[model samples]
Target: MIVKTKAIVFSAIKYSEADLIVCCFTQDVGIKTYLLRNILKSKKSNLKTSYFQPLTQLDIVATNKDKGTLEYIREAKVLLPYSSLHTNIVKSSLVLFLAEMLKNCLREEEPNPILYMFLEESLQWLDEHEGVGNFHIYFLLRLSHFIGFYPDASNMKHDYFNILEGNFQETKTSEYCLEGETVENFKHFFNISVDDISSIKLSKTSRANLLELLLTYFKLHVQGYQRPKSLSIINQLFV
Candidate 1:
């Protein structure tokens, strides 16, 4: 069957001399891999391999066998063309880091419209906005809501945030706790929206520490989530 859907490119691996195995998260199908034969063979090819860059949003007409095997796209075009995501160096690095995080964390094989919509809208916002130093921090924080581990911030007045428990506690009882400046910054984000993320500023060191803590929180709650290797590169870029 033919399906028209919107997909976010997660990662593309060169399969052979001229082929690419592209993994994408589709609004209609959660996670799908497509074999794009000869997409990289020539500049004259109808399917420009550039369309498959990390985190690009595309509108595609694809063949869906729905058989748990590799599918193929018959037609594809940019759905939401980014203004500066790929061209701006800082924004590009952010996209790369985000793509790697998504690749590691998004493992579902079924459609999740809510998650898809959140990603689609969020990326568009990232592209349009400036001063995005805090983008990834808030992005991952919001993502936890869909992944089932968004921090419980109802007790926001507490002095300590228990990472393993995913909530604020009156007192720290374990090693997995956020205290002092880190707790202040982390808790500030719990109630923020995407429009307000950039306003929650941090120094380079503070930002790096917060990212580490967020990944630690993820590792504790998510069974298979791995800290993204692109993390250091992103931190270095912002520095």
Candidate 2:
């Protein structure tokens, strides 16, 4: 099947001296892995290695056999080419970390237009903006909505957020819950655009705590979702 859709580069691994295996989350079908033969060393190939960087958006024409075999792209062009996302140290770290998170959580072969929009637009916003201290946290929390485990915002009066139950609670149900000032700060994210994140301020320590809480929520919901190895890099860059 020929698929022409917008996709975000998830991760690309060098298969040999020249070939590359790229995992992309496409707007047409949820997730597709493409084998880019000789994209690295072959100067004759039109597809360049720069087009497959982490979280880079592209319009790709590809063949999806759907026979449990790896797909390959016939043509690809960069979409919404970023200015600072790849150049700035902080933004680059966030890109690497978020790319890892998306790679682990997104593993479907079905079309998801809503999730695709969120990713494409949010990353573009991050690239254009300056304040990004809360981006990763906001990104993951909002992402849970499309992935099946966002916190229930109806019960805001409750002091504790039960991670396992996916709701607010008057009392803590398990060790995997959010309480204290963290709960208060966390709730503010439930209904706000990424651009408004500047209004919600947190100390470096507080941000770290909330990030940890969010990760715990993910682990309980997403099977095989291990902590991203690039986490420390994000924490350090933001702090």
Q: Model 2 RMSD to the real structure?
A: 1.1
Please, what is the TM-score per model? 0.95, 0.97
Across 148-178, the per-residue lDDT of candidate 2 in tens digits comes to 8887889988898888898998887788677
Give me the runs in candidate 1 sitting further than 4 Å from their true place.
42-44
| TM-score, cand. 1 | 0.95
Model 2: how far residue 34 lies from native, Å: 0.8
Task: Give the top-scoring candidate (lDDT).
Answer: 2
- How far residue 175's Cα lies from its native spot in candidate 1, in Å, is 1.9
Candidate 2 TM-score to native:
0.97
Tens digits of per-residue lDDT for model 1, 115-182: 99999989999999998999999999999999899988899999998989999999879888768888
Best by TM-score: 2
Query: What are the per-model numbers of colliding residue pairs?
Result: 0, 0
